[model samples]
Target chain A: MSPVNLSNNKIKLSEVDQSMKWAGLLFIISATLWLLAGTALGMISSYKMHNSNFLANLEWLTFGRIRSAHLNAVIYGWCNNAIFAVGLWIMARLARTKVRHLGLLIIAGIFWNIAVTIGIIGILTGHMTSVEWLEIPTYITPLLAISYCLIGVWGIIVFRDRQSEHIYISQWYILGALFWFPWIYSVAQIMILFEPARGTVQSLTNWWFAHNFLGLWLTPMGLAAAYYFIPKVIGRPIHSYYLSFLGFWTLALFYSWAGVHHLIGGPVPAWAVSLGITASVMMVIPVLVAAINHHMTVLGHFREVIESPTLRFVVFGALSYTLVSFIGSTMSLRSVNEISHFTHLTVGHAHHGVYAFFTMIMFGSIYFILPRLIHREWPSKILITCHFWFAALGITIMIVALHVGGWLQGLAMNNPELLFIDVMKGTIPWLKARTVSGFFLAIAHIAFAINVFWIVLSVKNKPAVIGTKALFTSPHAK
Target chain B: MDWYYYILTGFVLAGLIFISAVYAFHWALKNGQLKDLEKGASSIFDDDEPLGEQTDYSLSKSNYNLHTTTANESSKFIQ
Candidate 1:
């Protein structure tokens, strides 16, 4: 704790920051490019829902192919790569080690992007698997799998080389996520795709895999980022370590079991559905534990959280995590599931988790991380404000329209007197509203991309100005 | 046949996860990892120096036992 030691530690972390510069920049830039691409594809798919003939002529632009393309591009391209950038940086930073395998990571990152490119192309070419989340063709999955392992190895190495004896809670979540993903992914791929599990088992494996992908992989990484940034930015410890322990273990226990709820009312055994419903509802424990822990830590710091872009986005994400999780738990109940199961309600719920909860947190973490890695202030607070409002407002509208429309659609479908076409017709206006929200999200992402490029590409290293009104305080200042 | 196996697999996976959680919780408790509540939470901010002088005041009062080993300070000195 001597000043001399502190100085040395600063120098060491500064080196680690410099070491991550190129790989982090590449991962982020690639992630943003894919975000732009995915948003475009999403708009096309959304528009086609209401106007099926908009691009009906082009076989490649057919709704089915384009929709699958959109998912893979966003999930693998944007989400995965962004996690690589942000998550790996976090692992390296908290591990207090320079990234050792920089060259391998870059190579792995390149191949990861290439593999996803081939996967998207495969989907467009009518080779997509009919499975919901695993729609990417079989040939490209191994490449994606292998490259993910390669990138994941660096995190493991950083943990191995960590100088600190007491591992932070974020590392536990990150490490668990790093290891859990490939295990689940490989099992899902082998059982469902390669061996082709018989009948409803395929459905079981599909939902199990898809839901776990969100629960274990994306959720842990998002929570880890939140755990790190909320405490760091607010300059306070978490509310309680006991709650964190309970939260982590309970989440690990409950989330994996909750996946089977997705198969409710299907041919699956009633007992299995019951188990899933129980697990889903039980998820409230961990979700609230985490929510309370985060909110308590930010207690009396509301003004600070609101002022800091990073805390604002992170707190919003944490709030959405709480909201979406509760909604998810409720929707798993047989009564609620019956009505919301086959409608756009599930779609809204999905975005509420992935985009609102996970992606927004990543965006916030990037705002904190990029400035530190590049050692510069944000070029424009106005742009940051625009991005946040646009994204926030856009997603809110989309979810609301989809939820209301979906509920109505579900009701109409259940009634014997309502024609099928009538139910379909009732959803058009909502779908159009969703498309408009997509434009807002598109504008938000564009602003975000521009701001990131300006920060990364700018040559001037002007000292950052810090104030209560600043978009972000200089990383050096803290 | 597939349904039975699928059900069995789900049970096995859940059982394994349950056991793992219990084991992890036990280890955390045994190792005293769950104690020093404030220090554990602030450990992530170790790489950075203290936020400022005002932070040092609050941190000192908050982290009673390991007042000198604040994560921001300990993080710098651990190496």
Candidate 2:
């Protein structure tokens, strides 16, 4: 901690950020493009739910294909790209290592996007695999896997080259995610798609992959960002290191088994279903641990949460993680699953986890990261505020509408005397409300995209040197 | 036959994960990585970005100036 060493550390950290600049921007820019595309498709699908003939004439835009395309575009195209960008940068910074082999990383990123582009087109054109999370066609998946491996390798490389001997909590999460994704992904593909598991085994494998895709992959990456950003922004240590240790290990142990609960009342064996429910219920331990840690850390820093755009979005995401996880555990119960299964309630729950929790954290990470990468402050605070409110309010409306409508639909469906047509008809108003929410989400996304492009393209201010007093005292701060 | 395949695959995958995790936990414990929890928690911050200083905020002129003045005072005190 000598002055010279402190200065050198600053310079080294600056170097780490500099190395990630272009690759991070590439991933984020591509992620935004996918987000806009997914939003458009989501709007169409939501409309078609209420009005079947909204685009019935177009084969490619049929409801099934469009809906599946929307899911893949958001999860694979938007979420994964954002994870690569934010996750890798965080890993490199915590490891205090400069990301090497920039050319390979950028090339792999381009190929990854290309594969996603092909996969989306395939899904739209009716070549989709019809699997829930693995809708991308089999032919395109190998390319996706290969490119992902190339990109993911850099995380391990950065870890291997880390200057720090003590691995931070965030590093553990990122590393776990980077390794877990490909393992689950490849196994699911081989079992469900390539060899085609027999009978109920295929369904089992499919649910296993689908659930783990959220539980193991996206959840870890999202938590990694929360763990790092929450403490980093507020200038405080995590509430309890012991709690984080307990949380991480328990999540790792329980989450993988919890996915089987998706098949609660299906043809699966009673023992397997019971195991899933048990694991799901046990998830409350980690969820509570994380909730207490995050809430306590930010308890006195509420003012900072309001003032800092990054902290606001991340804190919202962290709170949603707790809410969504608890809801998920409840839904896994056979009694609750009986009502929620195959209903729009499940759809609302999915968005609650993906958009409200994971995507919000990614947005916050982008807000914090972009200034450091570009060496310039965001051009407009109004746009950031608009983006946050519209997104928050829009998702809130959509989840409420869907959950209420879905519960009514579920109740009606369970009644043998009720006509199926009437049950379907009852959901129209809720579907329309969802379309309206989609419109709000679209506006939020457009505002975000506009702000990003404006800041990137503008040359109004001189670049502030990072890791120096100038960064804090720039005359053109805003 | 299908049940056998399912059981074998499930057990193998689960066993691999369990073993790997236990090994990792053991390694961490043996390496003293878990010895100093306090230092580990504060390790993400550096002298330049020390503990108890807000480094990011929504862009605004007044807030920016306030933060800059605080940072200047902190730096002078450190010197």
Candidate 3:
């Protein structure tokens, strides 16, 4: 064995980390700050749902604006920035190449954050486009799209000069996501906002864009992180090569069509809705294949899963992906959609996929990637532990409350005898529960931010402990 | 009339993605991209372990095997 030098190799190992340090750190810090802001906005919006007059007098804090602000902040500000950090780091490492255009990436990241900032402010100030996830105003969309191009092209360039002859599954997903996001964004923007699709067609385009944004952009990126981290941490390979390929190709083939299922009973053509249903059901193949592969690989490694912070978060995300995708497929059925559509169930379902699955996985990737980038160790395991528990419990409470409460609300609405006021009243308690859950999530975010800032502020406080057998061998190697 | 354009765009985009995927899959197959399935999976460990050394799968598998065998032997001895 090569003499493992904690002191000497630490400097050597960090050459890779130094290539990405500034851009990666900036993206992560920015993403965590947005997470805090989003958490606050989410809490306010949930409170307003329960008590309509909580901030009724404030025009800026109205439910519509606050909720839109929360979504944009988390999706654009938080998730996109995190992906820029985590995704690019993974691509560079896997390709065994240093990131070029570091300066451009930093500029693009700054511009991207600035665009999201202005976009959120625009939404709050009533320049909002009111187009679901695309509420980031017309002016800023172009800026974001341009900055994203500047940032995203680096991944492909890195791959072009890769030292590794074989492209790993993670690269395929990352490359695909980088290509897919701009196409979907531009198409949705042009059709829905610029030219303006007529009536229900606009709604179809909206759902199409919204759903695929999650499916293609966030889902694949999240899965890519999980695929890379799980095997690396466990010191084992994925279960089956064939299953991985099937999962990827089937996902690429079926996910785009599954978007139309969002407009199941709408004025859209029945043929279109039927196609959506078929495609949604077809999603089971990919989801199950991925689930089986992950589960079998980690089957005997439960001890590692419990010990490693990264593995814990990632395995939770992998499990939630399975759960959420299954629920989503069933919900697309006509009978299920009858009760679930136009209800809080869909809202809960969205949080399940985006928060529980994607966000948790992103958190995992950050934990594993950040230390390497900074050439240091996390200062506080207590903070990390607390953050995990708070987030897990918070999202769980929110999802359960929303789905069950929404079910009753849906049933009550279907009844001709029941007054609408009573149905609204019925959801108040659940919304209140959701508000409390938001506070838990807020605490989690604060803890995470503190942990990050503490490590960053004291970057050189601890000696470089990387390149040791202990830290690399086990997740519990603190 | 514009709605037809929207619908047509969707179909064309879908067809393009489908065709691209097929071509990529064929290319991968022809180039032996999928031959050593285990290699790519093990490559991620480069960050965790010593550089330039691919993880030995058979070694790890045998370790796991030894673990289970020890457990079985212990249980039998206890009985």
Candidate 4:
């Protein structure tokens, strides 16, 4: 047993839980700031895609720059870091310990924030490699990679001291993601930035990085959250531990090879694309198993909690994870790829993963964690419900519109008689719907930012009179 | 533009619906096997208490296993 550090807990705001608390709050800040920045960039890019005159004055607000910012802020700033905060908490609690180098981890948070600041700035300043996700240029990659390492090392430190000898399903995923990220990021950076492979192969490397960016960086983290929360919510051990192993093995085996499907019928080798399609198709098994396991476990007693804002968003997100993966596999088929690959369908697919799948889970985990961190519950159930609806409806409308628009464009482009403008004419209505949907989503995000800020501020002042709840029955009211 | 296209689209949509339905059925089964819940619910009344002390599954609030048997499994009634 490790020596008791009783002195650590007696300080002003508990150094023990500080590892979890500050890190989580930083994530809330990081995610919100990035979200605001990302949405601003997204709207910019969206506007530029159609109305190219929208931001012609500012070089930093150019389409290429805005696109990169949108991706980086949302991916790195919002989702991954937020998961890191929650993942650490879940890891610590399961380990029957807190982060050992708590102070260092907090310092690493400072480092991470600094790295993201510089990376985003670098992108805006025209310092991008333009390699899709690895867009922060050579100078920023090392900083981002180093920051991730610092965070990763602390995760390993937490995992080393576990009360439960058997690693939980969530732990397996967190550990995998922790280790997998460095290897993927370092290799992608080295191959794309330093070496600069030419032409078709460079495209290959780009696709490789893009695919693995989601698979290695995100899929593991999101699944880990789902694994922890789904079981935790229902208060049951996951339906079958064996199925968890099956899901993990298949995902690791197939998903890494599955990224090249994005380059189907392109300059990449036919063999590579075929393998990608095969791997993607095989992805169905793992995705289905995971979705079934998560859904089934939360079947009965928690039907009520599903209506509860937290579970509602999380489960919807979980369902989206399954849907997106399935959609991804099917789209990888050559027949489907012909129409969907370069269309708005692709945009829809991407959002299915990022916004629907990851964001929803993040929302659920935030709801689960806030009370624990601040010792106060959310002020109003109505606001939370409205937040869920706005996001849910907005995303639903946007995805549907994109898919329909993409299909129409694909059909028109394939036809011999139709001009490209005809396709544009058809897509105009869907894009209009998307802008409206974006407004709804943005409002929801702002509402979330306010709610979280309110909860944090209320901790020192008058705590909100949170309604009676089963799990969040906190006695240590602030 | 041909009969095959019609067949293909019909088959694809049907397959998708089937897949969705199967997915739902799996969810329902996992949540609670309806027959099992019905059986468990009914068993509460059909059987009287055993000749020993009563068992309270919820006794240990924190450590309680919700999946462990609460119903009188030996008889068709609830005790």
Query: DockQ values for all predictions?
Result: 0.16, 0.35, 0.15, 0.02
Query: Candidate 4 regions off by >4 Å?
Result: A1-19, A460-478, B1-79
- Candidates' C-alpha lDDT: 0.81, 0.85, 0.80, 0.69
| Strongest candidate by TM-score | 2
| Model 1 Cα lDDT, one tens digit per residue, B24-75 | 6787789887776555555554324342111111111122121222345334
| Winner by DockQ | 2
Candidate 3 lDDT, B1-79, residue by residue in tens: 4857776666677677668778988988998888767555555544335322221111121221212212332122111
Q: Model 3 off-target regions past 4 Å?
A: A1-14, A461-478, B1-15, B47-79
With a 3 Å backbone cut-off (N, CA, C), the pairs that clash in candidate 2 are none
Better of 1 and 2 by DockQ: 2
Best by lDDT: 2
Residue A156 CA displacement from its true place in model 2, Å: 0.4
CA-RMSD of model 1:
5.6
Candidate closer to the true structure by lDDT (higher is better), 1 or 3: 1
Winner by TM-score between candidate 2 and candidate 1: 2
Model 4 clashing-pair count: 9
**Listing candidates in order, what is each one's chain A TM-score?**
0.95, 0.96, 0.95, 0.92
Q: What is the two-chain DockQ of model 3? A: 0.15
In terms of lDDT, the poorest run of 10 residues in model 4 chain A is A1-10
RMSD of each: 5.6, 3.1, 5.9, 11.9
Q: Candidate 2 — which residues are off by over 4 angstroms?
A: A1-11, A463-467, A470-476, B1-13, B59-61, B65-79
Sorted by DockQ (best first), the order is: 2, 1, 3, 4
Measured by TM-score, how close is model 4 to the native structure?
A: 0.80
Q: Residue B63 in model 4: shift from native, Å?
A: 24
